[model samples]
Target: MNTISAKYKKDFNMDKSIEEKLVIRNKRFQSRLMLGTGKYRNIKEAVESIEKSEASIITVAVRKIEYLKKIGKSNLIDFLDWNKLWLLPNTAGCQTAEEAVRLATLGIEMNKKLGQLENNFVKLEVISDSKYLLPDPIGTLKAAEYLVKRNFTVLPYIYPDPILAKQLEEIGCHTIMPLGSPIGSGQGLQNFYNIKVIIENTKVPIIVDAGIGQASEANAAMEIGASGILLNTAIAKSGQPKLMAEAMKLSVISGRKCYTSGIMTKQIQGQASSPYYGIPKLQ
Candidate 1:
């Protein structure tokens, strides 16, 4: 490690080789992973984790904060500190189509006041029941079609079914996010085969959101051709959140490299990688 580091440093600066460039939906990013802003200890800690994660898109909810609301800053947004992150306000906690649309519109209005949003698109979360808070596929489909008509780049979160993914794309969504498990479950890649099918079939970006317990899980998702991942509790709840964030970033990169390189095909018959008789080659 020391020898390689010294040699690389002598040839070219080591610090400059670390940072990577990422792009999504024509927006440039230094990282591919997107982090959710809920469940953080505080706004400061949230920002710290985001920085450490190197996530390009930061998912936030459109709910109002009463304290900030009384002072005419109802959304509790801090645009000044979030210059590097793309604001992806989600329609979280919305049980109905009307409610989700209103929240999406409100997010646009609030962020417009901040005056520097990179884009006007939003990440839509249309959850029906309050218990598990799982997404309503029917409601999500309806909302996505509507949002597309409204010229918004709708990124809809849904179950791991491919029919829903195709339906969302037909309805004009920019991306489809399927949960690996339930929200905040951290079970990690329970539906890997279906996810693989989705990646093989779909044209739009397929992101594996939720249920990623650790960096390895995220890496596996990337290796299977997922466009991106959304994580919050896994990092925020960890003892060393910032360190975990960096580890996740590297995992995604390595996984992506393997994905592009193409994995070796599996076989039913027994096959050996090593030569059976290495000394026979000398003859």
Candidate 2:
């Protein structure tokens, strides 16, 4: 692996390296950057940011908005182009399996109403901790099992635990989203080693979600072999969300290129760029 890594590092190039596409639940996507439809200044800015990001998948928190919209209320879906993007409804505030399962069912119906023609894909976020907004692994596992049995493509947001990731994969989860840090903290890859293990071991796509502070952080995650990244705070909280979104787009591209091209291994001893025999001694 070290030798391969060295060769790849030597051959790395932004334009010359071949890039790998992301595939989730049998669906192929050109862009691996997934954005959340929350925390923007407004719907217009959110839409513009998403457009700039060029993300094919956007996660929407399923809550009262769907219920209100059923009665002809103005909701967020009205402002989005469902045809151009895939909506991944998440049980953002659900604290239990029952709640997540229920919301997921409602989310599927909502997607249908919005003209989604694909499988009912849901991002399972069972957050029992309101303080840190961390996921409840028990609730997430329970909800994932139920959703998979119901033929929904389950993607659980979880901690960076390889065992838990493998468990979710065994339960038929479409993808595994491990947090880089606490949700919305912008701490950026605090659990990098665990995430790298998850990416290496899991057959399913591993998407690093939450706690990415900047576009460079996103690039770092991608370079370490994460299949994709799902972020909102990094872009939404920036001074210029649109430009930040574009930076994120390029970051993902560059990071994926580096990953595909193979990064160089670190060494304790330094290697000389100029050969000793070729250099003339200074007078």
Per lDDT, the best of the predicted structures is: 2
lDDT of 1 at 215: 93
lDDT, candidate 2, 1-283, per-residue tens: 4355654775553344355578887888879999997778887888889999999998888885666566887656678788888888888889999999999998888788778857599989899998998899888998999999989999899988899999999989989999999988999999999999999998899999999989899999999988899999889989999999999999988889889877899999999887699678899
The TM-score, computed over Cα atoms with residue i paired to residue i, of candidate 2 is: 0.90
- Model 1, residue 58: displacement in angstroms? 0.3
- What overall lDDT goes with each candidate model? 0.79, 0.88
When summed lDDT is taken over every stretch of 10 residues in candidate 2, the lowest stretch is: 10-19
- Give model 1's TM-score versus the native structure: 0.84
Where does candidate 1 stray beyond 4 Å? 1-23, 64-76, 269-283
**Model 1 C-alpha lDDT versus the unseen true structure:** 0.79
Model 2 residue runs over 4 Å out of place are: 1-17, 67-73, 278-283
Tens-digit lDDT track for model 1 on 1-283?
Answer: 4455664765465333334345456666667798887676666776677788778787777764323576775232562255666777788888988888988887776556556454776888899867766799989988888888988878888888888898888888878899988888888999899899888888888888988889999999999988788888888888888888898888888887777766899899989878798556565
